[model samples]
Target: MRRMTPARRILLLVAACVFLACTAVPAWRGAKIAYHLHTARYLLGQGELAQALSWLAYPLQEQPRSAEVHYLLGNTYRRQGNFDRALRHLAKARQYGWRREEVDLQVVLIDVQRGDVEAADPLLDRAAVHAVPDDVAVEVYEALAKGYLALHRIEDAMVVLDTWIQWQPRAVQPRLWRARIHERENDWDRAAAEYRQILSVKPDDVPALLGMAGALLARNEPVQALPYFRRCTELAPDPTQAQLGLAQCLRRLGRGAEAGQLIARLLRGSLTLEQQATAHYELGLLALADHRLHAAIRHLQTAVDLAPQHIALRDALAEALEKAGKSRQAASHRQQAERLRQQEDRISRLLAALAESPHNPDLRCDAGDALMQGGYPREAVRWYMNALKIDPEHRRAHESLARYYEAIDMPDLAAEHRQHATQAGAQPQLSKPDQPDGLRGDGPPPTPKACGPVQDQPPLQKLEQRAGPP
Candidate 1:
């Protein structure tokens, strides 16, 4: 490496500066986005989510069609726990043709939290198929499984659980739930197997132990159940529950005296209202088996009193009274249970109102979500578009439209609308995030197509790929 002369060095330096000057516009534009990213990250690190908004704002107005800007916006809102805003920006990021898997997972999480599991399923499925990180994939599956369980969609819950178990073989919660679901479905052998698998790993897991014991009792193998019930009692912090299980097993085995002692002790312990009712109900059952008619009637009455809303408790009390020759009281208890059942389902009422308000943008957005969940993308798109026709800035509908467009192979349109959604959200104004209304409204209305009326029209050809948000 020979040292260059001063004249030669000066000429080379000039050449380098000239080259940089020639590329100045693109460099400045790239630097602008880089500055936003670096500043946003620093603010985020300092727990100043609000402060970070201004940094991204400049870039967003400059590159409304930029997937990266919307992506930053989505994550910023996500950290703020503003799922609605987060989802809106995430959708734009996806539409801009970036990180569809990552964005879908976020959408699924938001939908699950909103109790719209139906809206989350397809996106969750897509995320599961993609190569997302293990933690996100697990969260996606668990959220869907738990959501389906809450809605009484048992089979759907099981399907997700199966996949979740496959992916996270060491996850204890899913396996426990899988076993519990099996128990509910009366698949005793499968239930036992799953519980045993959990026990195999976490030998002292109390829930699995209790569940396994209960399953054995359901199979009428009291002899097998007796030991497990005893072990659970030994492991339990509140051994009062163990006492009740022991009593049940002893009574089943025809050991009346020992079972009666256990039940009596259980009734004297500190217990929840439900537990008090359970203890009384079991004593009533054992007393009836021993032909103590008056004792059975008294205990059954106490159980019914403690748990007036429990149909089974009411039924058991009614039966004990009938056996004790009090048919009138049994009929009254039945009538009370009937009245409780007769109360209206409030969910049905909200659903009815939603059904009737088909044109309401919020309702239409919900309808669109449901349609999307049910695998009707085109119809969902129509509803989402219609929703925007009513309110162009409706964040969810725009986000949903971006998803629809992406699913149908229209990446360019997806990115455009997704970017549109970022601007459409309810983010706080931080240092003039956008240009004045004059510039914001520069784009013309796009032609209405299958996606419905345009919310923000397609930007002009020149602006579509501009440095700022179009």
Candidate 2:
């Protein structure tokens, strides 16, 4: 090759710089966006949702049309209970060429939460089963069960769990959840039956042992409970609860001294507030049985102090106080107990109202408030989210959620909802890419429509295609 002149060499250097600016600079920026997306995914998996969203912010700003970015954002919002934003981003992801099967499944899951079972049924068919991963299938069924449970549709929850059990016979979680539902309904026989089935497979499962023992104890069959409780204490990761259950069984079986000793040991160990309260209550009951009136009053009073909302604790204290001739204090406790019962009754009535009118945003908000007052903040969250599902800009629901997030130390979520609460007529809109329009923040809130047209096939039959009878 011929040697270049100085002027030509300078020109060539300039051209090379232009070429690098044209190709390499954009490539570097793209790489940085991809790195942010990857970090967001990792943070999401780690349950650091706030950190994940922060990491996603940069990529979302830089690559507004990126399918992967929107998809990740969608999932993060889904986990955060911001289903409206989640659906919007998921729609954007689908519009930008993300996998349709996954996007549609997510949409169906949201519909399920909206109590739109018909919309979910078509997508849950066995023919489409191979398109969804096993984990996704599990999520779908779990969402169905949880949604129905939240709506107090216990029968539907049972049907879903039964179908899940049929599909995954060996799954421990489903069986455990089913047992819990049974326990909730006071069906001790059925609850014990479920636990027995679980123990038949995983004989040493600590939860199963404890659950079986608990069911028998609830049925006042402590003789039958004793062996399971003993086994549980031996195998449990934390034996405190199991030992407590054993003490309860011992007390019920007329072994008060043994129960007292076990309870004393339990009190010496570290425990959650609720567990501590339970221990004190059991100790008080044992003392009362032995006619140690003063000791019974002390222990029961401590339990009531620890768990003031416990109706049983309040009742026991009232009884002890009345026996001790403190009629005034006993009357006060009885009145407090009545108030607690009324609060619980109000919550149940609100939930029943919600079940009858699932789309009523005001009813959902009221239910959430009632549940919060009744000492169930976690369950209250579902109602608040349901209210938001119906009316995204609902002031009371947003304010309640903001308070909840603040209490939980999730400042980002708290602030976001606070902002949403203040935004009177608008939502945060996504900038349009080159594709068709996704959900618009400025558009009117979705109409409060009933769950889609009912399927001709029965609920269980909708999921039974290709699978054997449920």
Taken over the whole model, the C-alpha lDDT of each candidate is 0.69, 0.77
Candidate 2, residues 175-273, lDDT tens digits: the string is 988999888768999999899898888798777899999999899999999999999888776799889899998888888899899889888889899
Instruction: For candidate 1, report its TM-score.
Output: 0.48
Writing each residue's lDDT as its tens digit, candidate 1 over 1-470 gives 99999999999999999998889978898898888888987765544577798788889887899887887788678655577889889988998997876676566666564335546545534433344444454555556665555434455566666655654576677888899888766798899898889889878777788888888888888899888888888887667766777777888899988988877777777788988888888888888888788998898889988886677777777788888889998899988766544422322343344433422466667767765654457766766776665466777888988888898899999998898789877565333212223443557422111110112322111111212221
Best by lDDT: 2
lDDT of candidate 1 at residue 338, scale 0 to 100: 67
Q: Quote the lDDT for 191 in model 2.
A: 95
Using alpha carbons, what is the TM-score of model 2? 0.63
Clashing pairs in 2: none
